[model samples]
Target: MNEPIISVSGLRGVVGGSLAPDVAMRYVAAFSAVAPAGAIVVARDSRPSGRMLASAVHATLCALGRPALDAGVAPTPTVGVLVRRLGAAGGIQISASHNPPEYNGLKLFGPQGRLLTAAEGEQVLAQYRHSGPAWVPYDRLGGWQEIEDPLGPHLDAVLSVVDAGLIRSRHFHVVLDANHGAGGALGRRLLEALGCRVTLLGEAADGQFEHPPEPTAENLAGVGAAVASAAADVGFCLDPDADRLAVIDEAGRYVGEEYTLALCVAHVLADRRGPVVTNCSSSRMTADLAQRFGVPLVRSAVGEANVVSAMVQCGAVFGGEGNGGPIDPRVGLVRDSFVGMAHILAAMARRGLPVSRLVEELPRYEIVKTKMTLQRHRVPAALDALEAHFSGARADRLDGLRLDWPDRWLLVRPSNTEPIVRAVAEAKTRHQAQELCDQAAQVIAALG
Candidate 1:
């Protein structure tokens, strides 16, 4: 059996092979052990293994004398909001996110309804490694309850962030590809609330996807066609867990995930005008939007928790990653597809422009990503060589070695779980970005 990919957020692995009930129980026990004794919200995506893992989490929470509030299958962000809405101590989302169907995992949340930070995750790991969970006595055993209205509060929160009245007046024709994941439940409701004439693909919340689960540009060809053929105002494609959203313009262009954060930031800054936060790997389009608004843009280390921490520190009105995850503090700390959809539409309506035009108004950059197989021990040497090779460019050693030019930048970082080094570059042209990535790859390879 392969080992699960355990990280600060949670653990993911192929079901039965690496992630079985025992492993899930142990991880859940570790989470419950560290969490304060209160109602813990448990939710899952539409994966086939979700029920088994969710049951394991529930039973473990109960056995540990901590109440478990079952939210059934829902998006990852919905679980976070539900945790806060219900005032639970923490939450667990049984989802592998964009991974293949065979993979499943647990996503743990802190009391304030956010993913655990690096320090908190380190504590969880230490507890899991050194000592077993501290179980409760029979007299102090916790209880269990089920909540069916998970989508209602989430929908309300999303609507609050946007002008629902204006959106409903527009009655935008929209198509949503939920990919048969847990997003369908709240997604459909939120669209209807905004008076969107919605054509839902994969409406059922069954784990079976109509295509590859990730909402990448290549995978979203069919969605683009659907939007154009239907003459919908826009199209929204969500990953299996629905936290990440990729947009399709009204003209049938695959705007991709990177633009999701940029467009949302552009809209919010136009009206609210405050500090914006995103991870280091995010596009400069966000920074450009901040500059246009005369606001400060703060960059955090990659990961939702890190971004949220920075947003809190900077009092950012909006924050997210470049991976199509938009975190609206008005809604919740978690990245929300519904928030992305609402804000994009509201931005379009307020601007009196089409999605394509809105995209064109922002800074344009091509992001190219590549990876090379390398041993973990060689990463330091590779970073040193790359730094020397790109000596003229300004370098940042925050999460990795990032070299920045006037309009281009390259990031070289090692994969936390895989034996590979990830390289990402952005420039005005695809060729330029590719060249940057290739150069980094060669430098890393030479380190051997």
Candidate 2:
């Protein structure tokens, strides 16, 4: 079997090839060993392999004499919130996120309802490698129970963060494309709670997606067309786990994920002025918003846990990533598609502007992303060349190498899941963004 891709967040791989039943069992047991002594919340996405993997996790938790609270087929953020609501030791979400259907993985969350910090995750990883599962005797075996209302707390949490009554007054016509992931029900409930007239695409949470589940521009052309045909005020698209979101205008234009954070930051800063945090790989729009609002915008290493740690340390009012993850601390530390939807709709309601107009108000930048297969050993050389080539610009080595200017920026980071270096650039125009990415790719290729 191929070695599974392991990280501080969690592990993922092709089901039968790398992530088999035994592998899942061992990993869950490893997590169980280090987790606090309390019930563990377990949830899965809509993928078929989710059930198989979840069963292993449940059995392992039970065998270790830890009670397992199963939240069946829910979004990843829901599990995060549920962990804190239930006062459990930690939580595990069975999902591969936006990866292809054949892939599935697990994401671990701490008791505070956030992804585990790097230090905590390293302890789990070390325990998994050095120790074995301590299965309990028959008399000490634990039990299992299914959660009756997993979505209720999550919905209430999101509603509390936004003015639901104001959103309801507008009665906005909205389209939601969940792509048959675990978010269908929650997405519908959130819109209905806000009194929006919602039209759902792929309402069934059967893991059978109508299109690719990433919510990218090219992959969601059909959804954009549907939004235009329905004449909806806005469209929201979610990934398989519903942690990421992308926006579509009434005219069927894809607003992409980067704008999701910018719009939410705008709405958040309108009412509260405090620090904001985003990953190093996120777009510069948030930085622009922070400056416009006269607030500090702190950039962290590229991960949800890192962002959450920074937010907690800085007491940030809003934080998220460029990949459509808007993390409102009032809601939960995890990236939440529901939070994104509420904030975007609330922004529209408050401004009385169309989705297109709301997007137009924000600073716009063209972002281009590309990746190249490069061995780990060559990464340092590539970074050296990139730094020397762009010596005129300010450099940031937080996660990888990020070079920045007043109007443009370039990021080169090695993938946590794949053996490739990803290069991303944003500028005033598409041509400039593409040129930056191409130039970085050339430098990496020359290292060969």
Candidate 3:
């Protein structure tokens, strides 16, 4: 807790606490050290600390003699798209994603427009802990420039994957809850391009969040009512960095994040039969869809990097985590909220169904998540005990301990960003899911 959570995935910390200008600078320096010989695109979400961190990151890049292509206040996926479109060596997004405002962090992208793989992250971490910044002299210092059109490439890429003409023809009304994160500008543009009559909430690209920024059911409770009040056809709520999405139907129903990927996957696979990938901790809805489509369902460990790695291995056409991030390979290889909104609207326009009706077509399941704080050394034994306690169920140790049954499942994994263990369960009903988590909790508690 005293230090930022640094990993290959990214670095996140409390703005004034574990995260500061120097921390941001050193992390960027490490990235610069390993990045290829080209400019590095830097961006941030609409957090207050983002301005401070962006300054330090640009300074670090310039000091290291790496040109800083600054795209101020863009979505996470937009940063990725800019990196590839601009032909940069890499990209860095200064946002803590769905974390609270007090938290801000960096997410790295490779030249391929994907999050740094675990191996690539290890290389970066080694530089951070072991090497000092390679400061340059005055003559060799790097330069900085601002990008003029950050959202255009990202918007065009997302619009390309969906039927823009058909969606525009529907002229559906939409409610966008950006919650003052970096999603508003690009999200608004994408919706307007699709010809949606927009009721945009928290449209400002400031850190002034009206609600919590995660876009969960609890965080987005008011969005459902807002959607109904606007008489909109659908509501799309985006997380802070705009990589994830959560939906609300016209009936004021929170269709939830898990359904985001499932809905998009089902829609894509209905037309194109290719392998689909999701994380192990995601809902079984994706697995069911892959089965229904007679395609392979590949479950990677829980992380965007892991999912992308699995996707590349399987050549998955459509993939995402359970967290409302659907990845269409046609778009840049990142978890994109724009991709979700466009595809969901296209699904509605093509099928002539409401968001809720489209949701009903998919098989339903309930998911429950709980956590416990245990020392790091005890984790393996704890998982072993849970595995033994649920001997009848199948177990998988891909990222953590996962026990599977026909209709329900439980996953126990250590938090990569927090000092706790997370246990998730899903089943046909909420009670069934809760019971599974409770059983797992008892097993994990008995270990202590």
In candidate 1, list every pair of residues with a backbone clash: 65-142
lDDT of 2 at 328: 96
Residue 62 error, candidate 3, Å: 0.6
RMSD to the hidden true structure, all candidates: 1.1, 1.2, 1.2
Model 2 ranges off by over 4 Å: none
Prediction 1 TM-score vs. true = 0.98
* Every candidate's lDDT: 0.90, 0.94, 0.92
Give per-residue lDDT, candidate 2, residue 381: 86
Q: RMSD in angstroms, candidate 1?
A: 1.1
lDDT over C-alpha atoms for residue 131 of model 3: 92
Per residue, candidate 2 scores C-alpha lDDT tens digits across 1-448 of 8878899989899999998989888888889888889999999999999999998899898899999999999999999899989899999999999988999999999899999999989988998889999999999998999999899999999999988999999999999999999999999999999999999999899899999988899999999999999999999999999999999999999999999999999999999999999999899999999999999999999999999999999999999999999999998999999999999999999999998998999998998989989887788888989999999999999988999999999999988777899998999999999999999988777776
The candidate, 2 or 3, that scores higher on lDDT is 2
**Residue 65, model 2, lDDT:** 98
Poorest 10 consecutive residues by lDDT, candidate 3? 1-10
Mind sharing the TM-score for model 2?
0.98
User: What digit string (tens of lDDT, one per residue) describes model 1 on residues 235-336?
Assistant: 999998999999999988899999999999988987898999999899999988899899999999888999999998999999999999999998899998
